[model samples]
Target: MAKTQLNVRVDEDTARAARERALERGMSVNRYIEELVRQDTGEAGHTFVEAAADFMKQYESVFAEEFGAAHEGRGEGSREHRNEGRR
Candidate 1:
């Protein structure tokens, strides 16, 4: 895989905070930023589907209470119908 360099400019306060936190964790500022980017990339961390599933699992009880039974497959009120009003 090819690697590229990225340069970002952050506010003084944010940079200070990042540097302090990185030092506390015994990691360099670059490594801390790299870990964050890797997590967001999904391919290296959790895929979007896996992340969504984990989120739903964590909030299943709250969602069930608010929205009632969770729909399985394409039931009566599926998200597939979301674009029906667009046309």
Candidate 2:
């Protein structure tokens, strides 16, 4: 694929950390940044929510057996109560 150069200005500390991360991952800073962009744009596949949902689906039977029918009676009020102090 044809690629274009992108210039981004970040703080020196951020740049240093990014370089260290790239080295740890055995990739160049350019490739590391490309991966970050890809993940941010959802081009890397299986976002966090999607993956979590998939995992839940896969373990639905086990979770249901462990938790039993208790979850069904829980209403939206429980969520509202839980978030009461946050915002």
Candidate 3:
């Protein structure tokens, strides 16, 4: 991949924070910012649908336990009697 230099300006406090975060992550400030952008943009590779599916799968048992019975019985009782023989 081709890399380009990007000049950016940040307030002194922001710059200090970024430097500290970069050190904590064992990355250069530029790399830390790049990773952040990549993750935010989903260029880190997982698509939105894939991410959502994974999240749902992780908590699927919780949802099923909570609503499975309610959903299962949702349409069992008819609201009104229908005219079965006449159109």
- Report the C-alpha lDDT of model 3 over 1-87, residue by residue, as the tens digit: 999999899999999999999999999999999998889898877766788899999999999988887666656352322333334
Off by over 4 Å in 2: 46-87
Evaluate model 3: give its TM-score.
Answer: 0.51
Comparing candidate 1 with candidate 3, which one achieves the higher TM-score?
3
Q: For model 2, how does the per-residue alpha-carbon lDDT over 4-29 read when each residue is reduced to its tens digit? A: 98899999999999999999999999
lDDT on C-alpha atoms for all candidate structures: 0.81, 0.88, 0.84
Candidate 1 residue lDDT tens string, 33-79: 88777777766545767889999999999998766655654574787
Off by over 4 Å in 3: 45-87
Q: Candidates sorted by lDDT, descending order?
A: 2, 3, 1
Model 3 whole-model lDDT (C-alpha atoms): 0.84
Least lDDT summed over 10 consecutive residues: which range in candidate 2? 68-77
Global local distance difference test of model 2: 0.88
